[model samples]
Target: MRVFDAKLKLQSQLRLMRSENNTIGMVPTMGALHEGHLALVRQALSENDVVVVSIFINPTQFNNPEDLNKYPRSMEQDSKLLSELSEELLIFAPGIREMYPESVESVSYNFDGIEEVMEGKHRPGHFDGVATIVEALLRAVSPDRAYFGEKDYQQLQIVRKLVSQKQLPIEIMGCPIVREPSGLAMSSRNERLPKRLRKEASFIYKTLQAAKVKFGTESAIEVSDWVDNEFNIHPDLELEYFEIADAETLRPIRRKQKENKYRAFIAVYAEGIRLIDNIALN
Candidate 1:
């Protein structure tokens, strides 16, 4: 895999590939490569002539500075994994200054109503930071398609909005959430989770699964309450919020609509490491 820290050099390489009519795909990530990240890379490899994965930990997205400080970084291991994926995979692991130079002004985006729910509401300016970095990466790579995991369902929707609002010529592909055998949603933050709490983290997804089942027979409020109670069973798992909402707009749904798609979104803290997961509610 060829690794480039400078965005312009990477863009130049991609532009030359474009001259030869090669289609490119990009998977933007914040390092700490796991099965979840490789899942996206695999999909991109299958469909595109070239795949570029950026591993810069975007500082602007984290509202809690401590969270940013603790975010994992394993570039050596990450490179080894990507190298195993394909010798042709381009790894863009740029430094913070490389991504946001001192002279560049901070960029913010209006995501309309999409940013007002879940992650956005809880972490103010989070999505704007997300949009800023994603927009920069999209512009730099200018790939035919970009890949993201559905685990962050709201962020996926907001990115879709960002691409639309900016009129960027790129397809945002949302891949399925990759999980462990115990049903825990795979995440980089999982590394920080104490090994004992790792198994307990599966409770987050298990609760979501149970909530999904109960949604078929209970009211939104009832199911929400049920989720709250389910998490109470595990003192280590702290429930922040759970909402049954319209999948499209992410607006909370008081009543289930046959015509509208819905999803259950939840956020929890397990041993102080925050984890988020979502499931489609039929």
Candidate 2:
């Protein structure tokens, strides 16, 4: 596999592929390669003539300075993992300055009201940072399709909106949420969890499952309360926010509408390493 840190060189290489009418697929990620990320890459490889995986830990996305400082980086290890998948894969691991030559600041985006709840409500300016980096990468690679995992379902929705609003000629594909055998949603932050807490983290998914079951018979508020109680009793996991919202609009709802799909979104702190997950209620 070839790695390019310079955006100009990467664009030049991709331009040649475009000239040959070779379809390109992109998998944008922060470095800390895991099976979940590889799953996206595998899907891209199956459908596209060429695939580009951009591994730049975007600084603008993190609202908390400490979280940004503590975020993991393992370029050497990440490169090894990608090489195992395919030698033809193009790896774009750009430095911060390369990505943001002028300054490391995010461009503001409206995202309609999609940016007003759940993650958006909690992490201020987070999606703007996400939109900024994603737009930059999408422009740089000029891929026909870009793949994103649905684990960050809100972000996925926002990205769809961003592309729609910007009229970018790219398909934003949302892949399924990959999980461990224990049901814990796969996240780079999972690496920071202590061994004991790692096992305990499975409860986060279990709670979501139970909440889903309850949604069948109970009210949204009732299920929300149950989720809150579950985490309140747990010693290791602390509930941050739980909302059952319309899957498409992402507005928290008290009653499920007959025509609208719904999902249960939960965020929790597993000993200070924040993990978020969601499950479809209908």
Candidate 3:
């Protein structure tokens, strides 16, 4: 595997691949590589002639400075893991200066209702930061296809919206959420969890599963309340928000619509590390 720290050189190399008629697949990630990340890479490798994995921790996306500061970075370990997966894989690990050459005003995006719920509600200007970096990476790589994990379900939908708004001719593929054997959603932030809390973290998924079951017979509000109560039993698990919302628009649904699809979106704080996860509810 080869690594490039500069955008120009990476794009230039990708250009050579395009000239050779090779199809490119891009997986954009903030490093601290885990099985979940590798899962995206595996999907890209199976479907595209070449796969480009970006490992840039975007500063603009973080609303909390402490969270940004504590976010994991292990370039050496990340590189080794990707190399073991595919000797031909290309890793783009750019420095902040490499990604943002100079300071500039923050970028913003309007996804209509998509950006007004759940994560968007709590983290102000978060998606704009996400959009800024995603758009920048998509523009830089200019790949035929880009892969994102559905673990960040709202972000996935927002990205789809971003692509639509920009009219970028790239397929945004959303892969399934990879989880640990205990059912905790795989996340880079999972690294920060204390050993015991890590096991307790699986409760987040368990609560979502319960919400899914209750959602069928219970009203949206009832199911949401049930999830809140479930979290209340565990003092360490602070319930941020739980909503039964339209899977597409992410607008919280007070009453279930027969035709519209729905999902249970959840966020929680365990010892100051925020983790988000979602599950489909029929």
Candidate 4:
């Protein structure tokens, strides 16, 4: 597989692909490859003739400095995993300087109305940076399709808006959220969790499931309280924010919006490892 770290080379490769009208798929990742990341690669492999994986940890997306510092990176190991997937897949692993060649004076996004709740409110400039980099990537690769994990459902949604608003020629595809046998969502940050706490982390999903079960029958307030109570069982966990929101808008549901399926999204801190999970609220 060809590896291009510089924009010039990547553009050259892309132009050549465009010339031949080759169908290319992209799996954008922040490295620290896990089964979830590989599942995206698997989907790409199955769909497109060429798969280009970008492994750049975009710094601007991170709201917390500590979180950025602790974000996992295993370049050698990740490269090996991708190679095992196939020698046909090309990897674009670039550094911050290369990706952001110009002084980015500002980066923000009007995510319709979805940016006000859950992740957007919690991590202020996160989705903006997410849009910035992913936008740059889509422009760079100009792939027929791009694969994203459904774990970050909100982010995936924003990417779709980007393609529509910006008029980019790319299909935003969301693959399933890969989980472990114990039901813990497979995440790169899972590597940072203390081994013991790792097993306990599965409760996030359990609590979200409980919230899903309680959704329409009870008030959003009651469901949130129940989630908080379930979380209290784990001393190591710190409740950041929990809410059942309109899945598309990411706003707190005041009444039953039967027209749209709502989602219960939660973020919690346990042993300094932040984890997020969501389930559809029927």
Clashing pairs in 2: none
Over the stretch 1-282, how does candidate 4's per-residue lDDT look in tens digits? 778898779888878877887899999999999999999999999999889999998888888988889888888899999999999888999877787888752377787867656888888888888999999888888899999998998898889988999999899998988998878888988888897888888888878877777885888888888888877777878889898888777778767856887888888888777898777776
**Cα miss at 247, model 4 (Å)?**
1.7
TM-score of each: 0.97, 0.98, 0.98, 0.95
Q: What's model 2's overall lDDT?
A: 0.93
Best by TM-score: 2
Over the stretch 16-108, how does candidate 2's per-residue lDDT look in tens digits?
988999999999999898999999999999999999999999999999999999999899999999999999999999999999999999999
Q: Look at candidate 4 and give me any clashing residue pairs.
A: none
| Regions more than 4 Å wrong, model 2 | none
Worst 10 residues of 3 by lDDT: 99-108
CA RMSD per model (angstroms): 1.2, 0.8, 1.0, 1.5
User: Which portions of model 1 show Cα errors greater than 4 Å?
Assistant: 103-105
Error of 2 at 188 (Å): 0.5
Candidate 4's C-alpha runs over 4 A off are: 104-106
TM-score of 4: 0.95
Rank the candidate models, highest TM-score first: 2, 3, 1, 4
